[model samples]
Target: MKVQRHKCMNERCSYDQQERIPFATGSCSYTHRLARYVIDLLKAMGLKDVSGLMDVSWDTIKDIHVRYLERHYSPPSLEGVDCIGIDEFAVKKGHVYKTIVVDLRTGRILYVGNGKGADSLDGFWKMVRKKGVKIKYVATGCMERTGCK
Candidate 1:
């Protein structure tokens, strides 16, 4: 269907012929409903794994997820967090180590990192400084570095 557009009075305007459509879509190619549906299934289906089921390219599914996150998600604020807990846990009996930082007040996982050491919490430290979060108490467990640094 052709859209009848009107031209601007100014000859210098680049977009002189502009058409307004009530059914125009946003920058995202997918419709709002389809995008939401993809996001809903994304958690369980996954982008790479869902490409076959959705019959779309892996990159397309990945882009859809990126757009979904950009529109709906924001990093949680660490402001007002006074207490935190950091611990290193072994996966498969010492083959892998992961460090996790949690908010003591709300019990939310703030940061996760591979390899346990002082540097494991570096990501959290940087975010804390940027967010101006003051830590009054910290409970750490099993800080032994297993040479995974």
Candidate 2:
């Protein structure tokens, strides 16, 4: 749709602005309804399939999905958190790995860090110290590697 551009008549304060569309965001090519539909389709389809079905680019569909996730799923609260589980797994075939910290009771992911070792958990430990989180029981996947009994 073509939005009509409005120009201010005042000589001193001349400004041009395009009319805002109620169903769409600023400068975005897709409407809110279309974005919602794409998100719904994503639940039952993959990214490439959704892109092919909607005739939109893969990157655009991924961006829309990411934006929706960011808007709805913020970081989980750390309050009243006691027991947590730490585990690291390779993101791909190579040495690249990621460490994840999850609340044992609620099964909610608390932190994700790059790499897989003691250093990867430094940030989480710092946060726990700052927040005074009294972690009583600790569980890890690599007991032998960490020398934990």
**Which candidate tops TM-score?**
1
TM-scores, all candidates, are: 0.69, 0.55
Off by over 4 Å in 2: 7-16, 77-108, 113-117, 125-149
What TM-score quantifies how close candidate 1 is to the native fold? 0.69
Clash count, candidate 2:
0
Give the CA lDDT, 0 to 100, for residue 15 in model 1: 56
Query: Each model's C-alpha lDDT?
Result: 0.75, 0.85
* Alpha-carbon RMSD to native, per candidate: 4.8, 5.2
Candidate 2 structure quality by residue, lDDT tens digits, 15-97: 98878999988877889999999999999999999999989999989988998999889776689898888888887795798
**10 residues in a row with least lDDT, candidate 2:** 140-149
lDDT (10s digit) by residue, model 1, range 1-149? 56676666777875545355444454444566766778888888768778888788888788888877877666667877899888888999999989988899999888888878877767778898888887898877654542221
